[model samples]
Target: MQRKFACFGGSFDPPHFGHLRIIESVLNAKEIDKLFLVPNFLNPFKSHFYFSPKLRLEWLRILCKESLKVWADKIEILDYEVRQNAPIPTYQTLQFIQQTYSLTPKDKMYLLVGADNVESLHKWQNFDWLQNNVEFVIIPRKGFRIPQNFQTLPFCAMDISSTQIRNKLACSDFVELSRLIPQPILELILKEINCKKIDKK
Candidate 1:
């Protein structure tokens, strides 16, 4: 039997509630049996990160452990890109997963992408191979166009963002921060919130 898996990669600078909701949505998806959370050492799309890659990875693990306890066995925290200690493309990550798990040609995995990245899909590294091998699951965002080829799940998409949380942390806005961040790692992030400086771009 082919095991269905999904990959949701992001910078996850602080692993907020928004990230958790996405994970829950994808895991609840009937088509996905397992989900992998890939935290970027540095998001290739931008320059500089607000927190260290190690810290981000740790926060992700904690988020999964506390909030996602129900999915302990169903979720995995991938450290491949973080281990690389640099910005790594999605194609490489997927390739590694494919080889590591011995997924045959017939065994296809799902790749979660934001709707904003839909139009520029071909600009991605090895777009053809990605489109052919794995199913592209679109996380709907208003004002962005989703292609017919991409799969859409009944995800409870939240409007929260890491950028907003970063601002809140900078200003020590605990009231709002408490609501935006995941309960498990909220204090963990506040403890060393100044680990690194970022552009907030």
Candidate 2:
């Protein structure tokens, strides 16, 4: 049987419930054999991050562990981006997967993104190559307007954002953070916060 792979790349500085729901929704809806949750070392579009790439990878691993409760063997946290010293574009990452895995012609691949990304899809590096070479699973973001004719998958519409979580963390507001963030992931974030405090001292 041919295997179908989907790549879900993001700067999951601290993976939260919304992100998990999106991944689960994709797994439940798609005919995918494996779903890779790749954490980028540097997001080309975004400039600042609260946690380092290494810490982010650690958080993703914690998320994968928690995700196993739902889909036992489907979720994988890939570190291809974190291993890179420089920023690598999404298209290049996909190319590396194709070459590294020696994917057969019969094997299928797809890219997953939220509606906000779809709105700015034209601004991405090598947009034409990305569009022509890979299929996409556009996920719906709470506020962003999705374009017509795009195949959007159902993700839980939570009014949560990574930025909001980061703000709560910075303010030491664990109550709100706990509501939006997963327990294991929150534990990892607390460790990162302590490390930052130690670095400052």
Candidate 3:
């Protein structure tokens, strides 16, 4: 039997507990053999000029360790998008994975995204190609309504976001930080916070 895998792509600027919850929820709902957490190297549409790619990757590694108890190997961080040096389109990423992994039509491959992203899917580059190749498993985001076409999936009404986590960190709200991210990820963020403080002086 072909193995089923879910592909979740994002900046994961600071992979938080909300991300873990989504992964866990997906695992529970499907017979997925693996979950590919593909973080973008340099998102064309999204502004990642703040955090370095290495730091983002490290934070994600720590979060995965704390929540999943598994290392980076299990979570494929395909940095192809970032390394492309040009605009990294979503359809290209999906196509590369299909070719690299020999993923046939029988093997299930899902593109895990949030409701906000699903709502904006039409604006994405080569969206028509993306729709034909990948199955989108969308999770809910705050203040975004799921479009009528996407109401069929096993959607979770998660209201958390990475932006909220970043805001809490900026305010030195360590207590809220712990609630938002995994213990290991929180430690990584704390270290970055302290480093930034020391640099200012």
CA-lDDT, candidates in order: 0.84, 0.83, 0.74
Specify the highest-TM-score model's number: 2
Candidate 2 per-residue C-alpha lDDT over 124-179 given as tens digits, one digit per residue, 9 for 90 to 100: 89999887777887888777887777777877667888889888988999999999
lDDT of 1 at 79: 98
Clashes of each: 0, 0, 0
Q: Rank the candidates by TM-score, best first.
A: 2, 1, 3
Flag clash pairs in model 2: none
- Per-residue error for 5 in candidate 3, Å, reads 2.1
Give the winner by lDDT.
1
Clashing pairs in 3: none
For model 1, give the 10-residue run with minimal summed lDDT: 192-201
- As a TM-score, model 3 comes out at 0.87
For residues 150-190, what per-residue lDDT tens digits would candidate 3 score against the true structure?
53246456566778888888898888787887777678678
lDDT of 1 by residue, 84-175 (tens): 98899899999999889888877769898988778777888888888788888899765776778668866756778788888888798999
